[model samples]
Structures are given as C-alpha cells and as structure tokens.
Target: MSTSRRTPVTTGLVTALVGFTSSFAVVLAGLRAVGASDTEAASGLLVLCVTQAVGMIVLSWRYRLPITLAWSTPGAAMLAGAAATDGGWPAAVGAFVVTGLLVLATAGWPALGRLVARIPQPVAHAMLAGVLLPLCVAPVRALVTSPWLVAPVVLTWLVLLRRAPRWAVPAAFAMTMVVVGIWLARHGDALDGPLLPHLALTAPTLEWQAVVGIALPLYVVTMAAQNVPGVAVMASYGFTVPWRAAMATTGIGTVVGAPGGGHAINLAAITAAMTAGPEAGPERERRWIAAQTAGWAYLVIALGSTALATVVVAAPAGVVEAVAGLALIGTLGAALHGAVTAEGPREPAVVTFVVAASGVAVAGIGAAFWALVAGVVVHAVVVRRASGADAADEDAATSPSPTPGR
Candidate 1:
C-alpha cells in the first residue's frame, strides 16, 4: 500500500523539482539583474514558488482543470537584461503589483484581452529577443573562462537535446550539480544554516518608471509568452480552461506575493505539457491529481529555498549563469526568428531589438520601454517614407518619363 502511494507521489514530486530547478536560475538572475540583493532574490523565489503553488492548487481543485502555474520566464529574462529604473527593487515590486492589477482587469473585462491581443507580435517578439540577448552570452563567455567546468554542462545539454529535447536544460543543470559537488568537496566548504522559509519584503512605492518600464513590459511578456500559449497548450490537450478565473487566480496570487519579493505568476507555458500529458496519468479526468501533487511539491521547494539560495551563492558565478544561458538558448532563437521574419514590421523590429540589446536607459526608465517606444516611432516613420517614395515613383512613371525620350 505504501509503495503504491509513494510511486505516484514521487513522480509528482519529481516533476515539481524539475520545474523549479529548470527555471530557478533564470529567476535569480532576473532579480539580480533588476537590482535585487541576494537575500531579496531568494525571498522573491520562495514567495513566488509558494504563491504559484497556492494558485495552482486552488484553481486546479476549484475548476478541475489541470492548471499548472509558473513565474514569467520571459519576464524574468527581461529583468535579467534590464537596467534598473527608479526606486530599484521597491519600484519593481510596485510595478509587479500594477501588473497583477492589469492581469485582474483583463479577467474583469474580456475586452482587455482583445486589446492586449492587438499588441504587434513582431514588436513583442523583438522586445523579448532584445531583452534576452545580453544574458544569453554567459554560457559562451563561461566557456572561454572555464572550459573544463562549463563544457561538461554544455555538452550534456547538447547530448540531451538530440534524444530528450524537453529534458535538455534540466540535464545541463544535473551535470552542473555533479561538477559543483566535486568542487565543493575538494574545497571543504559547506552550506550554512538549516533550510527553511524566510521572508524579505520591499515596501512598495508607485513610480512612473516602474509602472511604464517594469510593470507594463512584465505584463506584456507574461501574457504573450506564458499565459496565451499556456491556454493554447491546455486546449490542445482537450481541456476546457476557465480563462477568466484562471487569470484572476494567477493575478491575485501575484498581488499577494509581490510585496514579499515575488514576481508575477501565471499559467505554465512549458510545464503544462508535462502535467497535462499521458505521462501524468492514463485518464484525462484524473490528471488534475498530478497538478495537485505538483502544488504540494512546489511548496516543498519553497521551504528549501534558503538552502538553495545558499547553494547558488556559494557556487561559481559562471556555473549558475552557464546553465541559465543554456536554458534560454531555444527561447532566444525563437524570439529572434519571430521578431525578424515578418515582412511588414521587420525594420521596426530590428530597431526595437537593437535598442533593447544596447541596454540604454532614458528618463529613469529601463531600456526595454524605450526600445518599444523607439521601435514604434521608427516603424511608423519608415512606413510613411516608403509610402511617399512609392507615390513619387508612380507619378514619374506615369507622366514625366516622356521628357527623357525628348
């Protein structure tokens, strides 16, 4: 009896660990990239994990949807590449709250969904690509500096990418663990203190920079990259997602957790494939059970975040960054393709991409917001200029060309 229960429980728990471990470095790198201290970043991770777990459990049980929730990985990537805006982490928290409110507003008014949907895809894709471009260089740089250490992890990711593409990042993380373990054992260093929950909060303050730079962009990426695709993933699995309530659950969860350093939470984009699949269970109706188990499992991760935080700090910087960079390799490629492939907005998208990658800040706002603004203006200007040129050429071809013959 015990073995039977333990078997399913273990599967669910392993899924959660995989989920958490696969993305935690991205989250940590993002918080630090956005001006969070180490303690603050760890606190954010713990709060985000716990809050997402709560949202997942409640929404899954209440609606009986296999709702798997996650932090905005793209949003975190944006933060990782972003320059700090006014009020730093506190303002970022403030933006987080605004983002939560915006998400809730979408739930309240379905029209907002349509409005959000109108954001030009090329621009969105460009913004993400720009944001991710800087941080994705870490693995390459690490290879230059610590080839022996970083190569094994990168090689592991490459090998797994061929056979088990889904497991590639986690596999890289595993290889990193083995290398770091050996390094630690040889050095005689140990993680200090018992693993447990700890709280760190940044007092929220509304600032224009945070609202425009952090909140708006954060909301955009979460919706575009995570929630929208996540809903599609659920639909593909033949599940009916109560989209409004699902948005509300994630939004409200973010609101509650943001003051304590958590970033936004939303429906899982990637992990939904795991929890909503045949591997989760044989019966479709029973897959919510897997989601339930995942929730409890995430809570376990929350509890151990302090120790995890210690491990991250104690390890070499390249170690964490190499894995994070490897994890984002696929995302960065997709973003680049999506941003530039479209004919209409290609010029503007490149403008956006360059501004964002350059990491310039203006008027207390980060490069991301400015990048969007710059792209839009440039796109409009170029389009209008091209239209004028086309009109002039048509006039010349139609009427004035006879002078050349004379």
Candidate 2:
C-alpha cells in the first residue's frame, strides 16, 4: 500500500521537477535580458513560480483535469523586447496585471472562448510552431559560440530523450552542470561568488502610458501567442477544460503575484501538454491530480529560499541554453508538424508562421497579434470560398426534388 501510493506521488513530483528545471533558466535569462536587476529578477521568478503553482493547483483540483499553469514565455519574450527599450520593472509588473485582466476578460466571455475554440487546428499549430522555432534555433547558435561547453550536453540530451523520456530533462541538466563545473575548474573562474542570496521588494506603481501602451501590448501577446496555443495543445492531448475558468485562474494568480514582481501567468501549452499527456500517466484523469501536486510543489520552491535563484545563475549560460533548447525538441517537432501539414490551408498557415517569426511590432502590438490577423484573413478568404462552392453544389443537388414533389 505504501509503495502503491508513493509511486504516483513520486512520478508526479519528478515530472513537475522536469518542467521546473527545464524552463527555470529561461525564466531567469528572460528577466536578465530585460534589464532586471538580479534581485528584481529573482523576485520575479519567485512570484512566477508561486502564481503558476497556485493556478495549476486550483484549476486541476476544481476540474479534476491535468491542467498545468505557467508564466507566458511569449510574454517573457515581450519583456525581452521591452527591456531593449529600457522599460522599468514596475512597468513590466503593470503589464502583467493588464495582460492578466485581458486574459480574464476573454475567458469570461463564453462566446469569445468558443470563437477562439473555432480557430482551425492547422493555424493554431502553425502559430505554436512559429513561436517555438526561435527557441530551437537558439541552442544551435549557442553551440557555435561554445561548442566545447555545449556539444556534449546537447548530444547527451538527445540520447537520453530517445532512450529515457522521463529522465531526459533532469539528466541533461545534471550533465550540463558537470561539464560547466569542469570547465570553470580548468579555467579558474571564480567558483565562489556571493553565497548569500539577495532579496528586494518594490511597491506597485501605475504608469498609465506604460500600462496602456507597453503593458497592454505585452498582455495581448502573452494571451494570443502563449495562452491560445496552450489551449490547443491541451485539446490535442484529449484533455478538455473550459477556457474561461483557466483564464480566470491564471488572471487571479497574476494579479496576486504582480506586486511580488511576476510577469504574465497563463496556461503552459507546450511543456505542460508534454507532461500531462498520455505519456505522464496511465489514466487521463490522474494527470490533472499530478498537475495540481506540481503546483503545490512549485509554490513551496518559490517561497522556500533564494538558494534556487543563486544556483540558477551559477550554472553556465551555454549549459542552460542548450538544455532548454534540447528539452523543447519534442514540443518543437510536434508544433512544426502540425503547422505545416494542414489540408487546404497550407498557404495561410505558412503566412502565419512567417509573420510571427518576423518578430515585427507595430503601434506597440507584438508580431503574434499581427500573425493571427494575417492568417485569419487569408483563411477566411480562401476557405470561405471553398465552403461556398460546397454549399452551392449541395443546393443544386436538391433543387429539382422539390418541384417534382409539387
């Protein structure tokens, strides 16, 4: 009996850790890339982890579905863009709240959620593929810069993922650390930096211009780019949950954690789908319970200590980047396959992919919004015409039958 109960719990915990470690470095790197001070970045990560865990727990328990929550990676990427413009941390927090509200609002409207649900699978897959493509490309570029450091880790990750899917993320992370540690020892880089982790808190202040202009756009991108695709991924895995409730939970968590410096909280599409899919559990319903457990565990990690952030920063950059890229390979491949393979809608899907990949922004809106728009328009024009033709044929087929009966 003890072993029976312990087995699922252990598996759940290990699965959560895989997701946590796989993306944790990217979260930190995103914070740093956006000009957050180390203290601010650490705080943001803590808040992010906490909110993500809470949302996952609440939703998973209520719906009894393996619904995992996560910070919007696209939102993080938006921050990277915002950071390039010297946006302040407070502004970023404000953006998170605004984005949370937008997600909440969209989720609140059942019609809108249904409408989003109506988006053709191909386009959604294309968008997902487009969003993740850059991540896949990044590791290869990083290898070029630090082949000695990143090559072994990447090769090992590929091997482990092929042979031991469950152990892949943790194994790659451990291997990367070993390689980096060895390199540092040989190169004599400072092994001992500040052992004590730094903590700082900031009061939330509203910046209307930044909120409306920067924050709003950030929210839009996070939802459209991250959350929508997340829903699609879940559906693909045969786990269906109400979009509004998911959005509401995500929003509430984001709002709660905003003061603590978290960015947009949204459904985790790719990684969560990977873990909660049939691969993670024998029964479908059990996966939701696992996700809820993961949420609670994440919250524990968030509030526990600064040691977490310290360890993350101490890891070699190449190792972290390579691991992230490698961990996402499965997801990236699925997204690519889905995006490029839709019947009769290939052109529009391809258009969406290219526009999103362009990374262009206009009037503060991110590329993702535009990509959706462009794809929708093309699909509407093309697919609508095809539908009309089909309707006309049906009408012609039945037309003389009424007259004969008369």
Candidate 3:
C-alpha cells in the first residue's frame, strides 16, 4: 500500500494498541472492585473490547468520520472506588444497564443531553478527581509495601514519561508483565486453568443505591469526561460527529455488554486526536480509515483479554494495581487542574473535591454522587448570593440615594 493509505492503517492500529494497553488494567480493577469475580471481570474485558470494536467500525463506516469508541476509563475509575451494592454483582450489572439506558435517553431526548451539558464543569471535574484519587495513590502505597516489585514499574514509567511520553503507561505495563513473569517463575503453579476468552453473563437486579451510586455517577462521568470531549476532539480535527448516532451506538453496545460484565462504552477522546488529526495523514477525508483499522485492531486485542486477566489474577497484589495507578497519574493531574481552575465555581469545586476525596458514602450512595450534590448545592447558594449582591450593587449605582448629599 502507498504511504497515504498505509499511514492511517498504522495510526489506527497504534490508537487501538495505546488505548487498550494503557487502561485495560483499570477496567479489570474497576470491574473487580464492583464485585465481579475473576471470570466475570475477564468476561467484562472481552465484551468491552468486542462491543467497542464493533461500535467504532460501524460509526466510522457509516459516517465516514474517524469516530472511534472507548470504554469509559473515568467511569471505570469511579467503579474502582465504589463498593459493591446490596444487590452485589448483579446490582452493578443493573447499574451498567441503567447507565446504558441513560445514554440512550440522552440520544433520544435532547433535553436530557442538555441537562448533562448543564452540569457545572468544575463540579464534574472535581467528582472525577475525587474518584481517581484513591486509585492514583496506589503506586505510592505499593512502593512502600512492595518496593521490589513496584520500583521497576515506576522507574520504567518515569523514564518513558520523560522520553517517549505517550508510551509511558504502556511501557510501565510491559514492566509489570516482566515482574509478574519473574514472580510467577519463582513460585511455580501460580496460574491454573485455561487462559482463554469466554463469556459469563449474570441476570441484572436493580437496587436504588446502585442506581444512584453507580449508574448515575457512571453516566455522568462517561458523558462529561469521554463523550463530550470526544465530540470536541473530532471537531477540532474538522469533523463533526453525529452525536445522536454515536450515543445510540455506544448505548446499545453498553447494554449488550452489561450482563456480561462490561461497564460502559463511549466515544474515544485522547485516541480520537490520533486517528483524526494529521498524524493519521494530512488528508482529513480519509481519516475514517484509521478508525476502521482501530476497530479491527481492538478485535485482535480482545482475543488476549482472558490471558491478561489470568495474569492480573495471578500477579502480586500491588503489582498490577501499581501499573494501573501509573496509568492514571496524568489523568489525575488533569482532573485536579480542571477542578480548581474555574473562577465562579472554585469554592464549590473545592467543596466537591473535599467531599469526594473523603470517600464518604452516605445512605449507601457512593461518594461521587454525593460530591456532585454537594457541589451543586454549594454552587446554587453561592451563585444566588452573588446574583443578589450584583443586584444590590446595580440598584445602588442607579438609585437616587446621592440626591440627599447633592
């Protein structure tokens, strides 16, 4: 193939490679945190991959835009922090289903999408920052607890972070594989049973807490952090994504994958830049080929989900988590910056951050949902006071009070 054609294919493959390798650990960890068994987590991984791949292919082909899709990394992080619900794994699955439905609703109802857009940016960022805090700190705690195992991973990450930068997380993951292999070699019979992909579906059962705690938060984070940014990224590259169609595709994918352990899928944000930008070749019209290539690449990656899950299952407790933590540090920094930088909502954002980071779950609802509540409440009060003050000042400025002095 000519370089023009070959460039997008290679870029697309890289998009898939980087997207999958960098965050799949977090996805597994997130699924496990929400009460999925090892087999279930592996199943989630498989379905997440397959569904996203299919979504990307369909969207890119149908629209002829580089409309890539991804599993919700932020949503996964939120899940990692969330405790199991009263209904257990089934409830989590139910939350996933609800989240998918909400996404579908957003596509069907413009008002719903508008409501999501109305969420204060600082508050949204704060909630994500808080959800990510516990996971991002894992490397530090892991280093203290298991220095020998985690040190190499951290060092590799640091080195690559300064050098290649984009490959840092994936490289750290590679180091983790090395460390896991060595540890496994040292202790024979660590891994048992087949390491092959398979599905493990569970019938979903909804609980109010899980719906409020998990589904609501998942939908918000996926929308705010992934889908919205994804649309912007494509636009920046001179392509307007079909927002409703994209949401419909991802919502259906999420629902189909839910019973089998997947959390949620949405448009690709960071990876979208790679596939849609000049890196995919200077020809804007042809960049959709990159997304198509990425779809196929994700399918290829899916074949190894079970094997990777087995490794995660067998690795030393802190090792895989350490890699996951390393992958998220950049995201955590971005979230923090976004959370505190808004002038109008800074205090409310801080309040949200404190509450979220506190990890306080009230009445069985997770901290993320409560964080938004606190932020919005504080925001409303603050905005109201500010508006009242503005009104008073305006009245004073225009009033006849100075007539007495005159």
Candidate 4:
C-alpha cells in the first residue's frame, strides 16, 4: 500500500543515499580540518544527519510542501580549515549556536529576512565561489599526486556524466568503495573505534575573537550561501514556504546538533531539486513524498555514522579531498556564473572572489567575512562614480538645452 504523501520510494532512496555518499566525506574532513577529534567528527556527522532528517519531515508534513532540509555543505566547506581563534572546537560549537540563532531570527522576523534578502546576490555568490575554490581544485591535485586511484574515479565521473548524468556521482562513489574494500581487506577491522556511534558533547565557549572570527562569518555565509537561495528554490517549484516555520525548524535543529559538533542546518538547494522536481514523480503535489521518503532514508543512513567516519579517517588525505572536490565541481561553476553574470557588479564580484579565494584573514576573522566587506566597498565606490557621471551628464544636457533655447 502507498500513501498519497509518498509516491516514489526508489527516487527518495537514491536521493538520500547520494546525498550522504557524495558529501559526507567532506563533512568529516572539514570537522577534522577544523581540529575536531575523530570521535567528535563522527558524532557531528550522525547528529547532523538526524537533525536534517527530522527537520525535513517536520517541515514537509506541517506545510504539505516538499521542504528538504540539509546540513549546510557550504558552511562546512567554509569551516574546513577554520579553527576557533579563542577556544578551538568548543568555540566553533559556540559559533554554530550563534549561526543557528541568526537563522532563527531570519525566519521569525520577516523584516530581518527581507533585509538579508536585500543584499546583492552577486557578492554572496562570489564569496561562495571563492570559499569552494580550493576544494574544487583538489581533484586536479589528486590526479597529479596519485593517478592510479584518482584516474578511475575521475574517469567514472566523466563517463557517467556523458552516459547517464544522474549516475555520475554514484559511480564515482562506487569506484571509491571498491578501493576502500581493497584497503580494508588488507588491514582487518581491528580498529579501536566502535562501529556504532556514541555522542560526546563539548561545552560551548564564547569569546569576542571567536564570535567575530568564526561566529559572524559562519552566520553570514550560511545565510547568503544556503538559506537565501534555498527558499527561492522552493518558490520556484511553486511551493509557498512558511518562512517562520522553515527557519524555526532549522534553527532548532542546528542548536540540537551543535553541541554534538554539528555546524548548521538549512534548506537544501541541490538535493531539494532532486527530491522536489518532476524527476521525483509526475505529479507536483505528490512530490512531497520524495522529500518525506528521503528524510526517513537519511535517518537510516545516520545509523552508520561511525562506519562512515572511520573510512574517511582512514583514507589518504588526497583521496578524501579529491572525492570531496569532485562532488562540488558543479556547485563551484554555478556559483561562479552567478557571481560574474551581471555587468553591473562584475568588479565588486571579482573583488569578493579574490579576497575570499586568497584566504587572507584579518584580526581573528576568516577570509569570507573580509571578502564580503571588500566587495561591498568596491561596489559602493563604483556605483558612486557611475552615479556621479550620470548626474554630470544630466546637468550638461539640461544646460545645453537652456543655452540653445536662449
């Protein structure tokens, strides 16, 4: 028997599985990069998956919309090499809490969200592209370093992309799995880490430096990079997003997951497209089934957090990075196109991209925040100059007409 609320089982399952396999490696690698212990990273991964699944179920059920919630892939990317300037992982946890609160505010108060909405999209897009630049380059570097393992993965991705686009990422993952199996067979499962996940909470600590350096940037980037476009995606699919409800769910979810090392949660853009679109089903109203089913499927996958984390921890750094980077290539290209498509803001967008991609930090803050600020400055100056030129032209045109009439 099937429910009207759930029509596509296989679609939902694939969405959930691909969502985890394609990016879970990046999430673990990011936490480790930001100084989290393996156990802590495992906890974070499990908690986040559970949190997002719960959120997706809640929002989709309540609103009767195919609202897909996701742990912010871009946020994790931003935090990849960022350690708390003040208290390390605990401080990063604090930043996560702050980011969640900000997201809540955006949902609860439409006015504030509208303010965020007013931010120029080009700047946001530029910052996002810059943030993803290094990770996107990892595949090329991996090929240079370890051609044997990487060639197959990259080749599978390209061939599948041409042959069966939807299967490309999954095939890449399968190739990696084959490699993992070979490695594990050589070294038996005698690892000290438990196969099952156990959550360990880190007490949140706050410092001015942490707030400015980690918390602020995390909040802004997640807002611009994830949440803003997320709702837009829903709207494009003709679903009326209950702003407060959507924001509240993610904010609460983030708070719950953060203490367990989860970074932040937001509405899914890419994954949402998969689950909410026509490919999920022929009927638009019934597509909610896909998101709902995918939500449940994610919960099932969450059970293997420890196993997933172990594999990521054991894999060579280049291999982990290469896989993660390849997964994000499409995202990087889309973001870059968004950043530079408009003639009006091209300069500012470039400024933002360079500042962010350069990875320059100031005071305790990471490059992402400074990148936004730099872009805004450049945008303002250029707009001002253009405005002045327009004014001058108007004055000259008016004076010439007056002289001719006289």
The sequence of per-residue lDDT tens digits that candidate 4 reaches over residues 154-240 is: 998999999987678778877887776666677774455757977979998876666776667677777777777787887877877
Rank by TM-score (best first): 3, 4, 1, 2
lDDT of 3 at 72: 99
- Residue 209 C-alpha lDDT in model 4: 66
Model 2: residues >4 Å from true position, as ranges? 58-67, 73-86, 118-121, 191-245, 267-289, 303-308, 311-317, 363-365, 381-406
Per-residue lDDT of candidate 2, residues 58-127 (tens digit) = 8888888878777766556445434232246666566666766766777677665566656666666666
Model 2: lDDT of residue 144: 94
- Which stretches of model 1 miss by more than 4 angstroms? 1-11, 190-194, 382-406
| lDDT tens digits by residue: candidate 1, 1-406 | 5544444345567678778878889998888877788888889999999999998889888987678898888999988877687688888889889999999999999888898787777888888899898778989999999888899999999999999887888899889888888888888998654356778888888989889989888898898888998999999999978989989998898898888888899999778877787777666777787788889889878988877776887777698899998888888898899898887747889888999999888877788888878877887798899999999999888884455545
TM of each candidate vs. truth: 0.90, 0.77, 0.97, 0.93
Which scores greater on TM-score, model 3 or model 4?
3
Candidate number achieving the greatest TM-score relative to the actual structure: 3
Position 266, candidate 1: lDDT: 92
TM-score, predicted candidate 3 vs. hidden true structure: 0.97
Model 3 weakest lDDT span, ten residues long: 187-196
- What's model 4's lDDT at 108? 68
Please report how far candidate 3 places residue 311 from its true position, in Å.
0.3
Cα lDDT over the full model 2: 0.68
RMSD of model 1, in Å?
3.3
**Steric collisions counted per model:** 0, 2, 0, 0
- Most accurate candidate by lDDT: 3
Tens-digit per-residue lDDT, 1-406, candidate 3? 7899899999999999999989999999999988999999999999999999999999899989999999999999999988678889999999999999999998989999899878899999999999899998999999999999999999999999999998999999999999999999988846863488899999999999999999999999999999999999989878998989999999999999999999999999999999999999978899999999999999999999889998889999899999998889888898899888778748888898888888888888889999999999999999999999999999989987655555
